[model samples]
Target: MMTLALQRLQNTFGYDSFRPPQDQVIEALLAGRDALVLMPTGGGKSLCYQLPALVRDGVGVVVSPLIALMEDQVRALSLLGIRAAFLNSTLDTESAWQVEGALRKGELDLLYIAPERLLQPRTLELLHHCRIALFAIDEAHCVSQWGHDFRPEYLKLSALHEQFPAVPRIALTATADARTRQEIIHRLGLEQAEVFVRGFDRPNIRYRITQKQNARSQLKRFLETEHPNDAGIVYCLSRRKVEETAQWLSDQGWTALPYHAGLSAEVRQAHQHRFLTEEGVVVVATIAFGMGIDKPNVRFVAHLDLPKSVEAYYQETGRAGRDGEPADAWMVYGLQDVIFLRQMLEGSDAGPEQKRIERQRLEAMLGLCEITTCRRQSLLAYFGESEHPPCGNCDTCLDPVETWDGTEAARKALSAVYRTGQRFGVSYVIDVLLGKTTEKVTANGHDRLSTFGIGTDLDLKAWRSLFRQLVARGLLEVDTEGYGALRLSAACRPLLKGEVCLELRQDKRQSGGRRRQVSTDQRLTLPQRELWEALRGLRRELAEQQDVPPYVIFHDATLLEMVQRQPGSLGQLAQVSGVGKSKLERYGDAFLEVLQAHRGDAADL
Candidate 1:
């Protein structure tokens, strides 16, 4: 069985070996055992179920959440010469019947469908008669009630166990914490299944969080330097912001587009399609955009505003560098983000416990940005992996943060907040401290207070940065139930009295945009460069002919290998990493022709 699995992997999927827990998970599923798998994004989770279904006697029934995801998987599978199809709302009735007919005839190797469709009585009846392979549940974290991506329909997935007791079931996700993990096992009735807690760490992605100083300007600099020619996603917290950012980026000469739930279904689908199939397209979107998107080659994921939770940040950033290249998870946030999120949480309809959990999650996210040590370690610890070593790739690790004795400034800020009755907002309180003497300050008699003008040593930006750090340290609190007011916390007493010392991060940044140390685009010699473009052109032309994404034809990694190896025959070409028998037999001659022509040109030169 293991030999057959490896053979199918090589001859069909064109991979050499399994990536850690994938082989074990597949082995269990092939033996008719239930399994719960937690692998990071791009961790070969799909292959865990995909290979078993092909090797086993029946078609693998995959429960997917989104139509675009299903279509993408099916198309990529078809290119690999696997018989795959999807049953979704996007298909016409005739097309759906054809898929159902194929399923009954045991002609498909895999079938993808949404949970809503899978749970339907009609769909259940159809599956009952088919030669059922194991069931693969993707994005299984949606079952958690407190999760940001909660879907009520997912709660009913437990029925899969009762209905198909003999069918091996595997649940998989990349972003489940301890609570959500337990919920997945219990709610999915996978008590007896083997649970694989493959650690959540994507080291290739560099984490960088900066204070939001002119978010657009910072983002522009980050993009212009780090990922000038790469595809990426810019996430915003609001729909209006998504539109504005997308337009702003396009105006700056990037192929930018907007996507959110507010857009019509057609527009969203079209925008997502362009993003997936085109090169160097930046999609600015709210949280509604990136759940099941499978496009690799995204060089970065930038957040113009703070994410509501750490899990969302991880999952969203996981979209970049899926192909194991160096990518960035960059974000910018500020004090207002904290207040805005707190008030938004207070306005929610959730119960107290839920709200508390969410509040802690938000605080954890803020705390992550302010940490002076490696961020990857902190992120792993949050997901229950506590012993992770420091990742030297993050901003903190690359450039150590400088801290200073902020006790005096913190004392003055806290004293001012307390003296002002803790009723005013952050800006107004800062005004009182900076001795603005505005009408509101004088009317409130704050100008006459002893703490007034006590914080004049620091400028406005400096004070704002100090106050934000104080809030993050729990010395201050934002009023969630009331208006966005600054309040003194019990933790501030010692610092306010000068009995204890406080150290805060020093604000340091470039006054304007900056350049990269070196471009990441690998340098190719003259011959190699010409050959590289030729191969890509061929791949793009073939992809257009077939109406699929260019990567589906051949990933850039594969083409780069072609450029170096300069294979002269089909037999030699088969040695490339991603070259399988299906692709070799299908597109081998065309690629071989291009390669031969490039070789001739190089020889003539």
Candidate 2:
């Protein structure tokens, strides 16, 4: 059975071997067992269940949460000649009926259905008539109430075991911490199942977090310099901001779209479709935009606002570079962002215990931005994977942050907050520090405070950075009920008494040089560039004809391999990764022609 599985892996999926625990997970399912898989976003989670479905007795029943995820997977499977179908609300009545009929006849090798549809009695009756190879639950993290994404529908998925007691099942997700993992196990009754916890580190993505100073122009420069023609996602905190940013990018001559819950479902679906099918398109959206996005070539994910937790940030940024190419997780945040998030969290309707947990998560996110260490290390540690070495790809690792002895500066900043009656926000406090006789400051008599004019040594940006860092360090807490007023925390007493010292990252002003940019990789020569363009043009042509995303034909990785290896024959083309028998036979000839022409051109040169 294992030999046949390996043969199918090579012949059907066009891979020489299995990536470590993928083989383990597949083996468990093939042996009539269950599994709980925690793999990274681009870590080939699909194949673990997909190949077993083919090797086992009957069709695979995959429960996918998103219609887009289901459609993307089914279309990619169809390219490989797999009999795949999906039943979702997006389907017309006739289409849904046809899919149901197909499932009844045992015609689908894999059937992707939403959780609600699968839970319906009519759907269960249909499933009872067919032989099911296994049940694969994608995005299983939704089952956890503690997770950032909590779906009540997922809480009812435990019925799959009760309904089909004998069939094997596999639950999969890309991001889950210790708490969420236990929640999934207990909820899904997968305690006896083999649990595979793969590393959560996406080494290909470079993490960069800087303060927000003119976020729009900063994003533009990053785009023009780092990702001139790449597809990406820019996340904002609000629906109105999403619209404004998307329209602004469009006005600046980019293909940008707005996506949020505020838009009509049709508009949201249409924008998502265009973003998937087209190249060099950027979608500015709220957190509603990135779950289960399978686009492998997103070059960057920029955050105009801070996410609520590390998991949200990790999962959102994980949407980029799914093909394992070099990508960026860039963000710009300020003290106002901190205040805004605190106010939002405090105003939520969650119970006290839940609110406490969320507050810890929020503080952890702030700590990640403020820490002057390896970001990947801290991020993985948050997910309870602390054994990784320094990734050397984040902002601090590449261009190390410089720290200054700011004990006096910290004391002065703290004193200014205290002497001003602790009733004012950051701007008013800064005015008192700089001794600016703003009408409000003078009216309040704060201009006569002893801390006045003490901060003239530093500029406005430095003062803001210091205060943000103070809030991050818990030395100062934002008054959630009031209008973003600062209050010194109990943790600040020792520092205020001069019993402890403080060091802070020096917030340097941006010059013409700005942040150090990792020079973009230049792999293609003059001849290779022409061939690359021709190959991409051919891919776009074929994808448009089929009305599917270009990646379904071949990922950017496979095409780069084609350009580098210069495959001459169909047999040689088949050796490139991602070229299975069906794809080799379907697309091999055309890609081979392009490669052959490129070789001819290079020979002439």
**TM-scores of the models, in the order given:** 0.97, 0.96
**Which ranges of candidate 1 are over 4 A from the true structure?**
497-499, 511-520
Q: What is the lDDT of residue 18 in candidate 1?
A: 86
Q: What is the lDDT of residue 462 in candidate 2?
A: 91
Candidate 2 ranges with C-alpha deviation above 4 Å: 511-521
Name the TM-score of candidate 2.
0.96
Lowest-scoring 10 consecutive residues by lDDT in candidate 1? 512-521
Residue 168 in model 1: lDDT: 98
User: In model 2, which residue pairs have backbone atoms overlapping below 3 Å?
Assistant: none
Candidate 1 displacement at residue 270 in angstroms: 0.6
In order, candidate lDDTs are: 0.88, 0.88
Q: What range of 10 consecutive residues in model 2 has the weakest lDDT sum? A: 511-520
lDDT of 2 by residue, 1-605 (tens): 88998988888788889987999999999999999999889998989999999999889999988776678778889989999999988899999999988888888899999999989998899899999999999899999887877778899888989999899999999988888889899999898899998889898899999888988988888887777788999999999999999999999989999999899888988899898999999999998888888888898999999999998999999998898878889998988999898888878898999889888999999999988889999999999888988888898887788999989999999999999988989999898889899899888888788998899998889999999999888899888785999988899999989899998988644432234334223667777778778888899999999888998888888888888888899889889888899999888989988888888877887
Task: List, residue by residue over 398-443, the lDDT tens digit for candidate 1.
Answer: 7788999888888888888888998888899899888999999999
